[model samples]
Target: MSTVNTTPHTPGPLLRMSDIRKEFPGVRALDRVSLDVAHGSVHALMGENGAGKSTLMKVLSGVHPAGSYTGSVEVDGEPRAFADVAAAERAGIAIIHQELALIPQLSISENVLLGHEETRYGVIDWGATHSRARELLLRIGLDENPALPVSALSIGAQQLVEIAKALAKNVRLLVLDEPTSALNETESERLLELLLDLRDQGVACVLISHKLGEVMRVSDEITILRDGRTVETLTVERDAEGRPSVEEDRVIRGMVGRDLDQRYPEGEGTIGPVRFEVRDWTVDHPTQVGRRVVDGADLDIRTGEVVGLAGLMGAGRTEFAMNLFGRSYGRYVRGSLSRDGEELRVGDVADAIAAGVAYVPEDRKSLGLVLDDDIRHNTTMAALGRISTRGVIDPGLETVEARWMSEHMRVRSHGVDQTVRTLSGGNQQKVVLGKWMFTRPELLILDEPTRGIDVGAKYEIYLIVRRLAAEGACVLLISSELPELLGMCDRVYAMCEGRITGEVAGADADQETLMRLMTRTGEKK
Candidate 1:
């Protein structure tokens, strides 16, 4: 990987936390960990799920507060104790979490200057707020109107706005957690470029991400955490010829605590006869009348087959899946679904579930899970009938079933009663999987299942998908990551402008081939 040349005048140890130790009820979340970020340099923190990476950042950002953890935090060479988020901000530290904290109803200007609004004699100065917000937006290469509602911007643009909000705070140390997890390939590249620009402008950045390629490309230093301790810190080592080199294998070994010879598990199962089929399925935009989002899309998934759906963001893959799953998403939806040559009646979510179909949505927090609920409740939510009699839930039976399902899905939690909101992204995803698995569906539709999760967690999820297919269940996988589709699916259907434009065998699929098909112009009729 080519490295960005950091300015020679970069300052030393812009942010440092030493001997940090944190604990929970029965868990040592962080154990004597430490990190250092130099001004104008990008430092990346990486580890498998449940590792202490996030915990360490939380301590630094004051989410754990001063008395909750034992640590010495120094900002710009001055020792300081941060009691809360406000204190951290006062120390010029800003953290942007994976789940953005922006309010959708507010305008960009309002969201950017949220808590620290420009005021004239104690009254809010709307004009000055918009002016300064625009300047920050321009600094980050985003040229959108500051008056636009934050919800109007695309996901990529919204991410840039978040950084702009941080810049508005005069942040000297910026911490970004999985910033590119939801972005497409092009968007990810642009965001990396922006980070490099920030580094050049003397802002120290701490990036926590599961995408090792991005980490290796953008970071000057990488720290790997495992379990609850520091595993190793890595930098590009130069040889006698003064050429820098980083061993990808060594980084993987550090994060996973062992070497992973293969990233994806091989699926040795055979594809059986067509098990699920959708014919001439069409859906219209929910609010836009007469505008069809999915236009007569026809597709099929065979027993033991893992089929991939590849397309751009608005290509209607999700719309099609939602429409097929009991007409849950769109208006004026028309579809015909059949299993094993027999037509199925799917009028709503209940009917869909009764028909043995399950959908794991792309947005887990908003759709697939109840964040406030415990694993016990979330696990059995989709198939509660199995644990309930005459509308009354059997708590003991539910707990037993939840425990078994959590164990089967390898959900890492204190217990079944642990709130899902507190679990890591990988574990939360496992809970979603368990919820659907409890239903014993013959066909499973997973939409962006591994998004925002670590590499080790992704591998585990892939293994589960393979296991489902091997056991004679049909799996429909939808993802924007081309490599994921190529690695996991048996065949892929390329969608464009609400239609299936092309089909390719997964064994022969490459990024270029898939992209060409996905972006091809004509709609299939």
Candidate 2:
């Protein structure tokens, strides 16, 4: 399955940006950046965070008004200036942001037809709006009722809703920003198919994302940006002459301007006695606590081993971890939870942490970090009392510790005083790592540890995991990518429909075997 839109290449340019230069107070966001998009083809713009990609996309979509920067944007060989996003929209450029912009209180149809509402003079034309939304939804393979409130849909569905909204405006150049970050594999596949279909309809697309595999699969051309400058743009084709094909080295060389000998640094670790265990652990479905979502899952982690949990979406991996961590899920959980070879009660988060267990949840916004709070506050969340004295938070002490974490973790930010929401997803993930690292637990659980982080930062996190393992901390990682689990874990527990179906030695495991076990026959998931 591919996540890219494909097309027959024509010898004509659809969109072009020449000598683009923009500056912030302390950062030159883009310098002499030039790019071209062919008609009916997907052009992927790639770079590490703070590499001027976001700035370029904003400029292209007219979020940065004309005359604010020195740049020339031309479409179809004609010079045009976009004064605002509305002007760009009128020019058939529609952008979808990573964080969706639909209103929760509004229906899908309402959100889709928000600014361009169908109206007759002073009267709102609800009938026409609903009809148009229905048509767009059908085109995007969404059969869900368009009248349903957007809040009730999953993140993936809401993303499709965003696409449907964009489709309503008759866009020619569609800019998608990390569109698949929150989607499951199947949902992502479906979305990619939709993009391909759109390209067939003669719509050009510019995808700004960190996922290189997907970028290689769908894009005809890929451009790399680093430190606010345009690097080489690689053309991808089965018959391309004298160039790298689907290998990561060429892309890495362009993105970082350096060769990484090793993506993940290795460290020696000695396995000690079992530190955590769950016996006959079953989670009654969260909605129905007595019904099992995870049934009789038995797994163990040693003192210095990294164990990976791998499965498809809705396979109960996250649910099992949540139930194991703090009994946070399931109305009725019946199981034996143990730590350090001794029975431990984890009725709440406090009890779990007190017993030397820490979990970094997958959904950073809902379960991991508090977005409204600052970095210092989030880092001190799991173990606030340790940094506090006499029940009052010592602000100076907290800052010192947080500062150390920021430096060690290489969190890219001016200071811990900055709001966590303002930071990128990768940085927010680092803050989550700092929170768990500060807890100083024996067993640390990381779910989708490198979900949206760039290549450079992913290597850093991999090294961090290696360091933690070397220091005798048992880490549990849940990830959708099989290669990550195979590369990082010492052992792996494969799950399918709330059961620990298979186990493999990390050294002996392959993606095919793990997937077969995960997709077991006769399992009603």
Candidate 3:
């Protein structure tokens, strides 16, 4: 018998998606999209708002079943079609969405073992559940007790619990969608480290994030998608000098399909007289008696000036802003607020709006926009009077104003009739800004405005902020990113332990200086 030459078999990619095309009525959301993730490696998906990143992930996760979209998902070189989320989980694939799904009232063990609880005779075995939950928690570096309610934990801890839930399902291919969008700097770093550890343990990871810095730091390979199509997949490349690096400009060009020379829009404007002033602002905890959250904060902003509030997580920035706006949060709020040299009492939300103050909250989905409502309604919700006759809304006028806002904000959508929940995070943020702009406020307070948005969208928002300031609006911007504050604000106030520690001119501000002042407590101007 003649011995035939046999070639050695090579394993295929751990997961491969090819020729994905999804369509809705009058919209082709994804066009021939494709992806390949290697085993034990981190794959990053990059895209702008409404660029079909989430839609593609949904397809992979079986939120849209096999028949709903045209694509081929192969694992271990074998074609697999998932019928639903359960089917996907059966295939060792798990996805953690941006908005957490844990029930606040449930304990950590209960949430982790939900739907997959250990049972004896169809009765849930509480001891077994707690034991497994504890093991999973310890495996993920979470030291908290599993019996504690999820509500008692911080947002960062909640995210770790979410990961533990994924691990509980024995997930081999894990997808994290904007995992750190709501986390502070330290929390985000810790989360990224956990992902890296998971990767080293032979688990594949798919990370979807808008924070370019984090993406660059963690991704082994990056695939940029634009206009619902894959532009290019880039790997870490080295120059002739043999130093490993990836140029941010190269990634930006792939994401936007062009060169973006500037990351922030020009904020050149004339600063006029003081438009708003707050003196001795102090606020006690809403439920805790005699506990102060904001203490003796004195600040002032001029017309057409962008002021930045800088602090670490739990530095009491959000508490101060919420307490100042209509006293919507906290009790025993003692503050003197003035506009144009006239003292105003913001006793309620209605009074705050009437006094020319508008706030765009940080948690836009839950706190800012009505997700289930249509864009037209959300756009004009704040200033219904502008589009209403008497107390009744004029449908035609509402449509006109909504259309105007949609065009002005460049909101990418099927139409104004589309529900806000269906829009991307960036577009939803635009809707919130439009709603507040219609209020015609002389002072605008934006909290963590660009928290989860892409770089391109951030640039657009920066332009809008500058435009508002040029129109003589005093803009108070609160953000955790020091670069954002340095780039956009004319002046920055540092907060530490619920008090204003110090203030720095934007031109003279740096990260080290701001951090020093931010940690300096009990120092007041």
Candidate 4:
């Protein structure tokens, strides 16, 4: 790895944003916020959803630009006025957002050196492009051919490609927003190791993540924000063995402005008789012929029960849920679904919804909600007929129902008329949940329901899930986090390679036991 510096530097701190205040139409997103990042160190930016963490980063990265906000940005003790993202890059700053910016159809080399490509006389130079791209890819530990399209790579590999593009710009200070939210455990560890390596190479990083364990591991300093204001910044204490010594509770206190005695709320719902059942479920890969994505899966969910599905990535947990919910994913080879002792003939999404089945997909942004639409429209999207008459929506009734749902879901926004994209991630997730809850389903399938939200928002979501179960709704909760399953579920089913390996009661389940089942093969339970 090589250290790249694009500007003349005499540094105490590598970057500083002093008293930044930004405002949208009716909201003051950021209020007099200040931050400083030391050279060759990792600084974590922690906060609950809508705490202005993203807004502050946008101000620093020139997304909001210079005149759009009131602030002074200093790089290496010299004031910098960044008119756009290009100007920020010239000053050796790059930001990788949660949603990666990469063209799917473009090759790895092309995406890496998209804008800053080498030219020969009056033409393009392919040889130099691939050579430089290969060098950057090696630095990030991504061993793949540079000519392959970015779509062929996993989410983790594509993330590394984004980093390679930043290195191509000679970035000295990098900002990563929820870098591992979409990754599996292995991929996340790899990315964290890469961050530590970059820090050792004299690059400063501003990390914004909701995962406290990862934030505590690699960060040198932690800054907490609350309600668009600077709370306090704490230096991470280290033990003699060089491990972090700061308690996670202390950081949580600063972010939510209170002590969270319990990270996961206790379930108060009582398990009842079986209300939903699946037998001999099998689904083949959509494009790959004769390959079963989900095979011979059987499960039962009782009324007022919160069941959990546990597995590693690509273990067919999601595939099984989607196949059961109106065959939304994969090609259904065989499956028998029954609800309330009656067989269901769910050929499509409408049929599933009509059969009282609701699915909240894992990728909420792409599959659940229309980002450009308002909360009112999204909340009423699943059951428009409830708020419509004579095949036309009533504007007054829509407002009444949407407002009620927003309040019921505890969505924080300017108004029901506010655009869904402008809200924070937690609030956006609330809208997705609200949309599905409007359908009044007997069985609700929540896939990775609390994937990217903060701890406080996660607790609220847990409460909502419990409330639904208490009201006699059967909930099938799928999560990658093991602790989540153990905390909120009455029973958990482990799947490995498209087969159910074991079933465990939540009271007796532990990480080790679940791991054994998740990795087991050859036997179906």
Which candidate wins on lDDT? 4
Query: Could you tell me the lDDT of residue 437 within candidate 1?
Result: 93
Score candidate 2 by TM-score against the native. 0.91
Superior candidate under TM-score, 2 versus 4: 4
Off by over 4 Å in 1: 1-11, 237-244
- Cα lDDT of model 4 by residue, 1-525, tens digit: 664433556848898889999999999999999998999899999999999999998888889899999989999999998898999999889999999999999999999999888779967698888888999999989999999999999999999999999989989999999999999999999999999999888888999999999999999999999999999999997898867878899999998889999987787767889999999899999999999889899999999999999999999999998888889999999878898888999888999999999999999999989999999999998899998899999999999999999999999998999999998899899899999999998999999999999988998899999999999999999999999999999999999999999999999999999999999986799
Candidate 3: residue 334 Cα off by (Å): 1.6
lDDT of each: 0.88, 0.84, 0.89, 0.92
Model 1, span 1-525: residue lDDT tens: 122333343256887788889999888898888888887789999998889878888888888899998979887777888899888988778899998989999999999989878899999999999998988888888889999999999889999999989887778788999999889888899999999898888888999998878887888889889888888788855577744477777788888878888887899788989999989898998898999899888888999999999999889899988888888999846768999989999889999999999999999999999999999999998988999999999999999999999999999989999999988999999999999999999999999999988888998999999999999999999998888999999999999989998888888889999999899867683
Superposition-based RMSD of candidate 1 using all C-alpha atoms, in angstroms: 3.1
| Candidate 3 ranges with C-alpha deviation above 4 Å | 1-10, 237-244
Please count the clashing residue pairs in each candidate, in the order shown: 0, 1, 0, 0
Higher lDDT: candidate 2 or 3? 3
lDDT of 3 by residue, 1-525 (tens): 111113222387878999999998777889999999988788999999888898998898889899999979998788989999999988778899999989999999999999989899999999999998998888778999889999999889999999899888878889999999988777888899888888877778999999888887878889999989989888865557744487788888888888888887777789999989999999999889988889999999999999999998878899988878888888846789999889998998898999999999999999999899999999998888898787999999999889999999989988899999988889899999999998998999999998898878888899999999999999999999999999999999999989899999989999999999999977775
User: Candidate 1: lDDT over CA atoms?
Assistant: 0.88
lDDT of 1 at 417: 93
Clashing pairs in 3: none
Return the lDDT, model 3, position 85: 91
